[model samples]
Target: MTDPASPARPVAAAIRYLSIIVGCACLLLAAVCFAIACQVFIQTGVFAQSYVMVGLISAALGLLALTLSRVWK
Candidate 1:
């Protein structure tokens, strides 16, 4: 019979990796949105409010993901 602890190891590792990936993706999206906001500012001399909003949301998501990853263990 297989050891009961064996299957859980891979699942936990997968969750940890997934959390890290998602966190990084969120941060990257935030950066992209922030870049767009900057471009809008440069071209129009006015802030693109929507871009700023999205960037904030992405940043929050990233932070949440990172937090979850760290705490999962």
Candidate 2:
């Protein structure tokens, strides 16, 4: 029988690690995007809806990545 903690499971461990890394990156990106969006809105009297859309997308992506990281492994 194959051992659950065998070295052959490196790939699975690597994938989980990758997921955590990706989740952190996504969260960072979302924060940046949100900051940029707020800055743009504050600087420009005219509201650019696209910035909001981008920020929302980034936030969603970040949330999904984080959730995946938790669910993985």
Candidate 3:
């Protein structure tokens, strides 16, 4: 019979790589959101509260994902 632990190694690596990718994507999204929010406030003098909040949430999730990836192994 095959070793039960053999499949675990690759799975863990995949999870780590996926976590990093998601973290990067989320951070990029946060940047875009904040940029748009800034532009809107400058042009219309109206703060885009929703956009800013979304950005903040995305940033938090991204950081969490990165932390999980590092801590999982």
Pick by lDDT: which candidate is best? Answer: 3
**Tens digit of per-residue lDDT, candidate 2, span 5-68:** 8886887778777877877787787777777777877898667677677767877886787787
What is each predicted model's overall lDDT from 0 to 1? Answer: 0.92, 0.76, 0.94
* Clash count in backbone of candidate 1: 0
lDDT of 3 by residue, 14-53 (tens): 9999999999999999999999999999999999999999
**lDDT order of candidates, top first:** 3, 1, 2
Q: Judge candidate 2 against the unseen true structure and give its global Cα lDDT, from 0 to 1.
A: 0.76
Clashing pairs in 2: none
Indicate which candidate wins on TM-score.
3
Instruction: Quote model 1's TM-score.
Output: 0.87
A best-first ranking of the candidates according to their TM-score comes to 3, 1, 2
CA deviation > 4 Å runs, candidate 2: 5-8
Angstrom error of the Cα, residue 65, model 2: value is 1.7
Lowest lDDT sum, 10 consecutive residues, model 3, at 1-10
